[model samples]
Target: MIRHLVLFKLGEGVERDDPRVLEGVDAFRSLDGKIPEIRFWELGWNFSDRPIAYDFAINSGFDDADALRRYLEHPEHQAGVTLWKEFSTWVIADYEY
Candidate 1:
């Protein structure tokens, strides 16, 4: 199994209530149901003061690297990717299980 994790820091002036933020979160959470390769999905907004804490985090599970790649190319995932590029300042990742 593969675990795909992503942490995002929103761009300047972006807030929790922003449509872009909500759309990004909903888009990610919906992937498990929309894409076959996405076995699990979890997304959360940061509420901690830790420097490592980003604006949002996403954790996803896949059966293998191929499945993970497929999830990355999925249409719904692409929409989220576009939204991420528009609203995020930084994105960090680690993919290992």
Candidate 2:
């Protein structure tokens, strides 16, 4: 399986309560049922206020690279990406276990 993890930090001057951020978060949450390639999906806001911590995270699992690719190309996921890009920047780590 492929474990796809991502950490997202709100953009400078951006707050989590911003309408755009809430919309983006909802968009991602909605993907749990919409995409078939996803074997697992977990997402949430980060509680840490430390400067080095990210504001949110996405922890997902897929059957393989192709499944992961399909999830990435899914329209709903892309829509979330578009919205999140407007208010946040993210880093990702993918690995197999």
Alpha carbon lDDT of each predicted model: 0.82, 0.94
Compose the digit string of candidate 1's lDDT tens values, residues 31-96: 768898977788888889897678888888888889988888988989989888888965646466
Q: Which candidate is the best by lDDT?
A: 2
Best by TM-score: 2
Off by over 4 Å in 1: none
Residue-level error in angstroms, candidate 2, position 13: 1.2
> What are the root-mean-square deviations of the candidates from the true structure over C-alphas?
1.5, 0.6
Model 1: how far is 78 from its true place, Å? Answer: 0.3
TM-score for each prediction?
0.88, 0.97
Query: For model 2, where is the 10-residue window of minimal lDDT?
Result: 43-52
